[model samples]
Target chain A: MSTFRADLHIHSCLSPCGELSASPRAIARSARERGLHLIALTDHNSARNAPAFAAACRSEGLAAVFGIEITTREEVHALTLFPTVKTALEAGDEAYERLESEPFDPGFFGDQVWVDENEEIEGMLDKLCILCATDLSLDDLGPWCRSRGGILIPAHIDRPAFGVLGQLGFLPEGPFEAVECTEPLSEDLTDPWPVIASSDAHRPEDIGCRCLEFEAPEADFEALVMALESGKTRALYGNK
Target chain B: MTIKELQTDMNCRAVWNGWEDREVTGAYTSDLLSDVMARSEEGQVLITIQAHKNTVAVAVLKDLSGIITASNRPVPDDMIETARDEEIPVFVTDNNQYETGWRLHELGGF
Candidate 1:
């Protein structure tokens, strides 16, 4: 069995709040240098950066997953992962349609830029208001994303704002594979589903600082998803 | 008072003239989205200077009568689009929040 060092929640420059230096090339190089076995590119609300991110990961010989951190209409945040970049991007497009009716204003809340592997601007996603929650609810999110073949996990359950339990006061017990915590686990916290921790890093230094470790035959997307769903590897919350 | 009546009297300009017949029985004023979301009631006129797109979201979520960009402050271009799309009347006026509140008090029961 191989022990995989995985940081499955990370943002690229596509996120308006993300550091400009968190480009696809810079992330991949940093992941390799930090000895991360797997890194997932999870930009907020849109996965348009997956193509460039996956390409950079391949060049570095590091495993990568395509994912998005979506904020539902009720202001709850969730992380959705897809096995393929094509599927992830398509799902992102669908989610963008349901986002809050306001469009992104670079002058107001800053830029929501789409960049390539070399960190060149392709275009800006003007239709999406990246800062506020999208116009989707937890009930609407499960049926829509699962039909497109993606796994949803309530993100940062410890926080008071967008965390599922913090916002809704109870987990919906939907098609979620797990719940992610950015803070340390508390025996006081209880949920029917498993909990995992990630850096949810917006900067290169925070990447792999907190991650999930597991033993699998191979550290591929399929294996990681199975491991999470089957409850094989719970979490390895290493404080780096 | 109705949105059309208020706008006509205030000499407010329409950025996107939504259901003007919508009644204004109450009014809310705040810069924070969550504050508006939590405190504002339906059919109330929201009198904030906040000119972002999320302002439109809060208006819809809270079922406001209309949005007035106070002091003739420019609302974001997309915000007007959302107000129009949601059929929520959006207006702009030279009056600040104090003047608007005083006007609403004269109208009474707001």
Candidate 2:
């Protein structure tokens, strides 16, 4: 087995808050240029860009994980990673069904663009992707993601905004596989689950700023899951 | 002004009055808990739309006078329970944060 550098909390242009330059092609190229072997496309509340990200990663010769940065009803952010593009889209559908139907305003909330692997704008998401899932609570997210062969990791637990510990006062008992922190892991947040770090990049240049080094036979979704379960992961911080 | 006086004068509904009415020297308004924790001082009531358990936790940490959830935001039962257990009274106001802040400003005490 070999260690692979992975940034698992990247946002595509599909996220309402993401920069327009952060297209799937641009993200894949940037990750590759940064010497990252594994990456994930995690847009806010939707995985509509997963298919394009898959194609982009293929052209860049990088292994990709498909997921979404889900905003739960409690306004807590969690990274939900699936084994394939299909499952990621399915999870996105579940989150979409729980959101309030608010129209997307480009001028105010920024554009939610859908770009293909060729760096072409195909269309735009109709509803605001940043809206919190008003019906899906934090407790329900774990079981929902797990039932569909996905893993849920509370994103940026140390952040005071849009974090599980920040929004819910404390982390409640849930089936969390791991937790993500942008900063160095604090003793106050030491829990049974392993702690991971990601850049949570919303722009191309920020890719791989923070990542994880994990030993896996191959930089694939299943191998990554196995690595996490076996505790063969190291949280790598700083720009590379 | 005291928390009880603020609630009565502003016509705010007392959702959870677990603590004794105490003086409110000032008030801070922000939905971001980190901002509230950093900028707010003790004896200040927090006026925000964030009606969650974490808001109560921040109030306890900062020793705020009380919490006044503005804009008719719904306070979950769990948050109310936490406030009660922490001995921090929570009030709900129909007015938004801007209106609530101005009203408190007009009250001259805080």
> How do the residues A1-240 of candidate 1 rate in per-residue lDDT, one tens digit apiece?
788878889988788767878888888888888888888888888899999998999999988888889878767788888888999999887777666544434543356777876789897787544435566788888777778788778888777546776677777757677788876666446355667778888888888878888678888888887787676665667757
Q: Please list the C-alpha lDDT of all candidates, in the order they appear.
A: 0.77, 0.84
**Per-residue error at A204 for model 1, in Å?**
1.3
Question: For every model shown, what is its TM-score relative to the native structure?
Answer: 0.69, 0.72
Top candidate by TM-score: 2
Please list all clashing residue pairs in model 2, or write none if there are none. Answer: none
Q: Fraction of true contacts reproduced, model 1? A: 0.00
Clash count, predicted structure 1: 1
Q: Could you tell me the lDDT of residue A129 within candidate 1?
A: 41
List model 2 lDDT by residue over A1-240, tens digit each.
998999999998888778988999999999999999999889988888988999999999999999989877677889999989999988887786666544533564477887776778887877666633446788988889999999999999887668888777787887798899888866567477888899899999999999999999999989988999999999988866
Interface RMSD of 1: 8.2
Error of 1 at B49 (Å): 19
Which structure among the candidates has the greatest lDDT? Answer: 2
